[model samples]
Target: MDDKIILAEESLKRNGFQVKIFNNSEEAKKSLLESITTDESVAFGGSMTLSQLEIYDDFKNRGNEIYWHWKGEDRKKELAEAYKSKVYITSTNALTLDGKLVNMDGVANRVSSMFYGHERVYIIVGKNKISKDYDDARERIKNIAAPKNAKRLNINTPCKFTGKCNDCDSPDRICNVEVIIHRNPTGANINIYLIDEDLGY
Candidate 1:
């Protein structure tokens, strides 16, 4: 286990987040599937980590009501249903050592759901996404997370081509909204699952 990840877990726990450390994504996936009940509807945000976990398919096959925009053509309808689901699972762009979750979004749905409209929100974080502090977290999001996601989605944004944040004025900008969660949202149980692997951008 990396020292940084351990430190982050301590800090996040101090800040009132339920922190769990895993050796790898496979272990994390096993635990997630076992813990997240079929009785409660589950929702997922746009996350490479969750995609890699193949949780949507696993849950769908298990007869759990699932909602994710990436699953079908009805993105708007799916997004609405996702927000209303009992359990919300997603990932943060960056997790600071001092206990902060930093994220940037285009559609704003994922970011909003992080702090609202869910009985429980599970944040799956890979070791690569950890940072020293707030500034470092946001920096990585712009240069690393945002750019990679833009390229993956084939968006016509400068970051996608430049492999860095150009801070372009394009209407298709992925970082249209940003949020920094200093603590868990009111009336929501937030779980932070920290895996020691480079799972997502």
Candidate 2:
């Protein structure tokens, strides 16, 4: 196993989180499905892994209500409702070898929901999304993740043209809100499934 990945798993384990490392996405899916079945009221935040797994459909099919922030949706209403809702699925932009969850969002839904709303949270990560350190993780989002997301969503942010974070104040700035998950809540629960293959952006 890669030393960094090993470190990440160890750090998360020490924090009282259940860490599962899989060889690929298929294994991740199987494990994830089993985990979800054991829990009640599964909810999902925005995530490329969920999109790759098409896991939201699975949750909905199984009668689990997912809470998430959508692009171009009414932010005020979504934020209000999410405050009290429990979230089960969410994606972190980058995970450092030391098990730091780093992400940037326009509305901060993804980060806040992970830390607060959910009674039990499950974060799915791809090895490609792992970084050497916190600074590298954040930089990856600012340069690679943000620009690619902007292009994919056709956002009109300055970084779309510059191919790097320009710290734009545009309404389309997806990196406006940033959050780091350093530790799981004392009494709350969080689990991380690390997939060896690339899963999401």
Candidate 3:
């Protein structure tokens, strides 16, 4: 792997996150399963990376309560009252080599839940998601992840046409709330798994 990835991983660790670097997604899947079986409750954030992993099924098969943003039209109401419990399978968009967890969301379910909902949260990231710094990471998600994701969802965002970030506040802004996880909370409640392979938007 590259030095940037190593540096980023080390920085993440220093911030109090339990960091695990995997060689590939297959390895990541195996490890995530182990964690899920041992944990009492497992929750999922809105992560394209985790969605693409398609590994949450394993957690469900094990009789674990897998939580995620409700897709129902009444999700806002339901999620507002959902149990704030330990999450064992949440993924995050890695922002920088300086070790920030930067992310954008529409409903704020994914981002808000990260703060206090789950007693324990697991963050999975791919090496390709790493950037040099906060600005670079933001730029990447704006110019790359956001546009591509909008196109993928057919959201009709400005990025779908401009092919880059104009930082527009259009109603279709896909890059709304952003979060930079500067440090993991006290105790090893948050675990991070970094795969060498590329994953996520």
Candidate 4:
């Protein structure tokens, strides 16, 4: 493993999160499959990273009940089902080298589930998402992830056209809620899986 990854894993471990590093997404996916049982109820937030990894179908093929608003016909019902699920999986916008998970969301469902309700939370991060510190991480989210995501979602925010954050008050702004997870939430078994490749915005 690279030194940065080692340092990150150690730091996350110190914060009481189960940390795993993979050389690629395939290895990470296999590890994820083995970690959860077939009958478990799995839920997910809106994550392009997980979509890139094709995890939803994998879990479904393995007989795990999935609740993802992106894949469901009914968004509200899916969100509710996801909240009640045993395992929640998602990706972070930025991960600090000092072991903090940072994310910006519009609806806040994804960030909300990371801290509570779920029995286990799996946060899969690509190496490109890692930042030197919290300030750098937040910047990455605002200037990089949020803008790119807004464009991807076709949101009529200034960032979507400018390729940068204007901190706009646009109704379609995706940067409504921001969450920073410094440590594992009480009674939650949180896992941080760091993948080598760049996978998401």
Candidate 5:
């Protein structure tokens, strides 16, 4: 493992989060499959990392009850179902080496699900998401992740065109809510899987 991965793993574990470091997405996916049972109910936030791993398809193929608003027919119903799921899987926008998880959300569901209504929360992140510290993590989200996401989603935000956050007040601004997870939420078992590969925005 790289020094950054080691530091992140140690810090996250010390901060009360279960941490796993994988050399690649395939190894991470294998471990993920082994961690959850076939009957477990799984939910997902909008995560390009999860999509890259095709985790949803794997879970669905295994007959696990999975809810993802992005893939569901009824967004409202799926969102409600996801809230009630046993496991919630998502990705963070930035992960600090000091054990902080940072994310910016538009609807707030992804951030909300991380802290409540789930027995276990699995956060999948790529090496590209790691930062030197909390402030660096925030900057990574604001200057890199958020801007790229806005352009990808075709949102009319200044960051989309400028490739940087202007702290815009646009209604379509995706960086509406900023969340920092310093420790595992009360009553939730948070597991973080750090993949060596760059898999998400």
Candidate 6:
């Protein structure tokens, strides 16, 4: 095991979070599918990592009530149901070695759901998303994660062209709100699944 993964897992456990480790994304996806039941409703955050997993169709086919603004025709309705779903699935932008989870959002529905309104929260992270410290984690979010997301969403931001954060005042900026979770929220059973390979930006 990588030293950073070990440290992050131990630190997360100490912070009252359940940590699961996998060698790759396939294992993580398989475990998540097993852990969540069709009887329970599932919601998705606006995360590229979640998109990579591509489990939405499977969940829907198995008769799990699904809520994801990215997939549903009525985004507003999906976002509302996601806020109060039985399970919330998402990924963090960055996870520090000391166990801090960091993320920035444009709309904030995804970030807010992590703190409350769900009985269970599953955060799947790739090893490459882990940083040495909090500052580095935040930097990774601004420089790497935010820029890539801007390009994907085709948001007219300066960073979209530069491939770096310009801290612009554009109306379409995607990183308006940032959150750093130092400890697990009391309202949900938070589970952190760490994969060894790089998965998302």
lDDT of 1 by residue, 83-161 (tens): 8899999999999999899999999999999889898889999999999999999899999999999989998999999
Task: Give the per-residue lDDT of model 4 (tens digit) for 52-99.
Answer: 999999999878999999999999999998999999999999888788
TM for every model, in the order presented, reads 0.97, 0.87, 0.87, 0.97, 0.97, 0.97
Off by over 4 Å in 2: 68-87
> What are the per-residue Cα lDDT tens digits for candidate 3 across 37-78?
545766676677887788767776778665555332565544
Q: Kindly report which residue pairs in candidate 2 clash with one another.
A: none
Candidate 2 structure, TM-score to reference: 0.87
Task: For each candidate in the order shown, give its overall lDDT on alpha carbons.
Answer: 0.91, 0.77, 0.74, 0.90, 0.91, 0.90
Candidate 5 lDDT over 161-194, as tens digits, reads 9988899899998988888999887788999999
Q: How high a TM-score does candidate 3 get?
A: 0.87
- Which runs of model 3 end up more than 4 angstroms from their true locations? 70-83, 186-188
lDDT of 2 at 82: 56
lDDT of 6 by residue, 1-201 (tens): 677888999999998899999988889889989999989999999888888888888899989999999999998888888887899999999999888899899999988888788889999998889999999998898899998999998989998999889888999999889998999977568999999888779
Report each candidate's C-alpha RMSD, comma-separated, in the order given: 0.9, 2.6, 2.4, 0.9, 1.0, 1.0
Where does the lowest 10-residue lDDT sum fall in candidate 2? 64-73
lDDT measured at residue 44 in model 3 versus the true structure, 0 to 100: 70
What is the alpha-carbon RMSD of candidate 3 to the true structure?
A: 2.4
**For model 3, what is the alpha-carbon lDDT of residue 132?**
87
Q: What lDDT does model 2 reach?
A: 0.77
